[model samples]
Target: MELLRTKNLTKVYQQGKHTVNALTDCNIRIEQGEFVAIMGPSGSGKSTLLHLLGALDKPTDGNVWFDGKDMYSLPAEELARIRRQEIGQVFQDFQLIPIMSAYENIITPVLLDKQKPEKEYVEALAERLQIKDRLHHFPAELSGGQKQRVAIARALLMQPKLILADEPTGNLDKESAEEVLNLFIQAVKEAGSTLIMITHDAAIAERAGRVLRIDNGRVTG
Candidate 1:
C-alpha cells in the first residue's frame, strides 16, 4: 500500500531579489515497509524534499498525502500530532539535546507525547545500536559515532510508521558509518517501518531497496 505520495510538490525561497527553487513539481510515491534512498550533490534540494515528505516544512505548492489524508490541508495541531507520533526524523547534524543524557535523549519523543517509554524496547534498541553502554553519558561525553547512534536510537524509540533520515552516517568514520548503517537497516526492517534515507555515497544508497536521484530540485528513479 502507498504510505506517502506527493503531487506537483514545489518549494521556493526568496533571498533578497533572487528566488531559489528548492524543489520543483516533484511527484513520488512511497509504499509501506520499503527502504528508499535519495542521492544528490550539494545544493540539489535533497534536504528540502525530505523536509517536505516528513512534514517538517510545508511546500509552496501542490499536495502531500500521507497515509490517506492531504497533510497540508489538515489543521496545524493535527499535522503536528502526525509529525510527532507517526514520523521519525534522523538529521545529519545528530540533533541531540546537549543537556540530556543519551538515554534521556533517546526517550525524549515518548516523554514529549506524555507517554511512558517501554524500558525493554528502548534497551533493546540501544543494544542493537551498540549504545547501551553509553546511555548514561551526556551527548557532550560521547564520540561522533556514538552520538549518531544515540540519535538513531532516539528516532527508533517511537517505532514510528515512517522514518526519514538525512545523511545519517555523514559524520562517522568508514567503519563506524558501515556499522551504523547496517544496524539502522536491521532495526528498520525489524520494526517494519518505511524508510526514506538521503545519502551522497553511492555504496550506501545501494543498500536501500530502491534508489531515487535528485538534481536541481527534481527527482528521478
Candidate 2:
C-alpha cells in the first residue's frame, strides 16, 4: 500500500536578489515496508526532497499525503505529532545527547510524549543492534559504530511507520559503516518499518530495493 506520496513538490530559496530552485515539480510515491535509497551529489536537492517528504520542512508548491491524509494541510501541532509518533530520523552525526547514557537517549522520544517505554522491547532492540553492553555508556564514551547502533536502536524503539536516514554511515570507517548498514537493514525489517535513506555510495544504495537519483533539483533516474 502507498504510505506516502508527493505531488508537484517544489522548494525555492531566496538569497538576496538571487533565487535558487532547490527542487521543482518533483513527484514520488513511497509504499509501506519498502527500502528506498536516494542518491545524489552534494547540493543536488536530495536532502531538500528528504526533508519535505519527512515533514521536516514545507514545500513551496504542492502537497504531501501520508496514509491518505494531507500532511501539509494539517495544523502545526498535528504535524508535530506525526513527526514524533509516525516518523523516525537518523542523521550522519549520530545526534545522541552527550549528557545522557545510551539507555536514556533511546527512550527520550517516548518520554517526550509522556508515554511509558517498552522496556523489554527496548532491551531486545539494543541486543539486536549489539549495543546492549553499551547502554550505560555515554555517546562520548562509545565508539563510532556503537554510537550509530544506539541511534538505530532509538529510531527502532518507536516502531515508526517510516524511518528517514540521512548519510547514516558518513562518519564511520569502512568496516564500521558496513556493520552499521547491516544492523540497520535487519532492525528496520524486524520493526516492520519503511525506510528511505540518502546515500552517496553506490554500494550502499544497492542494498535498497528501489534507487532514486536526483540532480539539479529533479529526479534523474
Candidate 3:
C-alpha cells in the first residue's frame, strides 16, 4: 500500500531579490512498511523535501497525500492534529527539553495532545531501545548514544504511521551509532511502521531498504 506520495512537488524560496528553487518537479512514493533513505549535499533540498513530506511546510506547487488524503488541503488545525498523531520526527540535534527527563521527553507529544501516556507500552519501548534505566535522567546527563536512543523511543511511542529521521546518527560515535541504528530499524519493523531517513553517509544509507538520491532539487535515483 502507498503510505505517502508527492506529485510534482515543488518548493521555491525567495531571498531578498533572488528566487531559489529548493525543490522542482519532484515525485516520489513510499510504501506502507518500507524503509527509505534520502541522500544529498547541503543545498540539495533534502531537508526541504522532508519538511514538505512531513507537512511542516507547504509546497509551492504540488500535492502530498498521506494515506490517500491530501495533506496540504486540510485545515491548519486538522493538519496539526494529523502531524501530531500520525507522523513522528527525529532530528540530528536531540530536540529534548532540557528540564524534562527521558521518560518525560518521550511522552511529551502525548502530553501535548492532552492524552495520557500508556505506561506499559512506553516502558516496553524504552526497554527495547535499551534506555529504560536512563529514563529518569536528563538529556544533559546521558551520552550521545543514550540521548538518541531516548529520541527514538519518543518517536516510536505513538506508533506513528511514518517516522521521519533526519541524520539520527550524525552525532554519535561509530559503535553507538551502529547500536542505535540497529535498535531503531528493528523497533520500526516490529511496529510495522514506515521510516524515511536523510543521511550524507552512504554506509548509513545502505541500511535503508531503498534509497532516493536528491540532487539540484530533483531525485536522481
> What is candidate 3's local distance difference test score?
0.94
Model 2 is weakest, by summed lDDT over 10 consecutive residues, at: 151-160
For 1-221, candidate 3 gives per-residue lDDT tens digits of 99999999999999999999999999899999999999998999999999999999999999999999999999999999989988999999989899999999999989988999999999999999999999999999999999999999888888899999999999998899999999999999999999999998899888889999999999999
lDDT of 2 by residue, 1-221 (tens): 99999899999988999999999989899999999999988999999999998899989999999988899999999999889998999999999999999999999989987899988888999999998988999999999999999999888888899999999999999999999999999999988899999998999999999999999999988
TM-score of 3: 0.98
Instruction: Please give the lDDT score at residue 220 for candidate 2.
Output: 85
Please, what is the TM-score per model? Answer: 0.97, 0.98, 0.98
RMSD of each: 1.0, 0.8, 0.7
Candidate 1 stretches with Cα past 4 Å from truth are none
Q: Tens-digit lDDT track for model 1 on 100-130? A: 9999999999999999999898899999988
Clashes of each: 0, 0, 0
Q: Would you list the rank order by lDDT, best first?
A: 3, 2, 1
Q: Give each model's whole-structure lDDT.
A: 0.92, 0.93, 0.94
Candidate 3 residue runs with Cα over 4 Å from true position? none
